[model samples]
Target: MNTPHIAASRRTGFFSRSGVRRLAVALAAVPVALLAAGCSSAKSSSDQSATDVINKLGAVPIPSAPQTQLTPSADESHPQLVAVGSAVAVTLPSGTGTITALGPTEDLPTPLPATMPTQVAGTITLRVATKTGTVKVTTTDLSSRDDHGNDIALTPVGVAQAAATAGGTADFVVRGTFSSGAAQITLREDGHVVAVWDFNIELD
Candidate 1:
């Protein structure tokens, strides 16, 4: 009779339903896979950026505990020594600010701008923060000096200006040679000298 055909149709319907269910389950997994891939890619990119920054700075952040916050002297004749990875409290024109020498860097993407034949000795990676909502730190506001009181020119890289919000911070890099034994880095705010960070350079 036609009973066999009806049974065959029922079997086909059951198989079709099962196949649809399997297809739905596979489709559901796709989004999860894509999300996982995106997260992995983001993490990898972050790690690469960190590595690049470290390489640009010749040395990594000091492993030791951070030192006390340094209060920079207005007197340039005797600037205080600033330890690596230590924070510096500065008085900006608008209000107060902070600068931290994160570490030394040397693998600059471009050569250190120098008139004489000079090699990139090292770089100071700085993190600057200003509570003043409108205040910013620019490369032109900073300068360096050697132990004997000669100017050691600086070439800034990365962020051109550190424009921070009231609670946020920005980072910048300045590479220079220590041929004359770099001694201090001075920061000025609106043509007024505000801070000086001292460094003890040991060449290798």
Candidate 2:
């Protein structure tokens, strides 16, 4: 009888419908997977952008300096000398931070002082990490003194302001016009000297 044939056809149709449903489910999941991947890529791009901003702070050409001294000493006044490419950790009023001397740059100071011409220029990167509350650090909080007892002027470069909150970090770039000879970079927070680094400059 035709009843048996009908039963066979119905079974085949059921399997076909089930397979189509499975395919639909798989197709629906693809967009979600792609969206997740896109989110990850976006985060990576954002992190890279942060680094780019820091590098652009020294976009101008830098003259070569032949010497960098980072000798450790027992004298409490001068603990350790930080090399040009090295980083030093410091205690912040609100949290902690690391300061790195990115080395000299040719970016001269604006409107060169008629009396005090700039002998050298340099840049430094500061990273602030906070866990308790929001904290802000700026180039204005820094000072530099040359071996000749000259006070070098410090200024903020790209992304001038750095602010961080709980479990967050911020990057800041600071540029300064230094005099000839070795110089010292100092950081002051809340009217207290918190950190320091030395740089030696040589010119042809």
Candidate 3:
């Protein structure tokens, strides 16, 4: 996939003012307490969905009875703000270069991360290798969906902006909180992820 291949695209509807009015009218018809109770119950059920991925990743690298859940559960529809994409032609800031090849996590060169913990927690410096001419780079947030079809938000630690050169490496060190289990971090531009990093973080 040279030019970034997007998974299947689905059309999501937005909530308009009229739609809100209708929903308000419908809600007003029901007892407020019942509505509150229903919402609370839904929240409780969804909270557990995120952990399902972490547990499964640990038990089976590949699930025997693997079930895929769309991010933002298909049941509870959410409008997609816009077409997910990276900043087009978002070049490096200043004193930054392009990404060529990533180097090793410890000692990196190009297209490689400079430093990363064998595991990660809060925030850390993430490095990538490109050319000696690299500078003015930034790493963006990562997004992934779990088994429950809900989007998991991830933040990078470094620069995800486009490098100075067409081919260079960069490191993104974003703060993140993950449970003890298996997961992958995706590189995002706009709302889409273009790259990925897979690892496991033990909850300490």
At residue 121, give the lDDT of candidate 3: 40
- Give the per-residue lDDT digits (tens) of candidate 2, residues 1-204: 556454323223324665455445555554444456556756477655544654565222222222343422212232335655555554455654444555666555477556554376667666665555565677777777889888888788776678888778777777876666788877667656655677777542
TM-scores for the candidates: 0.50, 0.48, 0.29
- Best of the two (2, 3) by TM-score: 2
| Candidate numbers sorted by TM-score from highest down | 1, 2, 3
**Compared with the true structure, what per-residue lDDT tens digits does model 1 show for residues 1-204?**
556454323223324665455445555554444456556755477555554554565333222222343355332233345656666666555555667776466544355344533344677777867765544667898888877887878777776667666777878787777753457777776666666677755443
TM-score of 3: 0.29
Question: Which residue pairs clash within candidate 1?
Answer: 57-105, 58-104, 58-105, 58-106
Tell me, by lDDT, which candidate is best: 1
Instruction: Show model 3 residue runs off by greater than 4 Å.
Output: 1-120, 124-126, 131-141, 144-152, 155-170, 189-192
Candidate 1 lDDT trough over 10 residues, lowest sum: 58-67
Q: How many pairs of residues in model 1 come into backbone collision?
A: 4
Q: Give the TM-score of candidate 1.
A: 0.50
C-alpha local distance difference test of each model? 0.60, 0.59, 0.37
Model 1 lDDT at residue 188 = 72
Which digits, one per residue and each the tens of the lDDT, describe model 3 over residues 77-147?
Answer: 22122112211122222222222212112222245456533433444333444333444335444454333
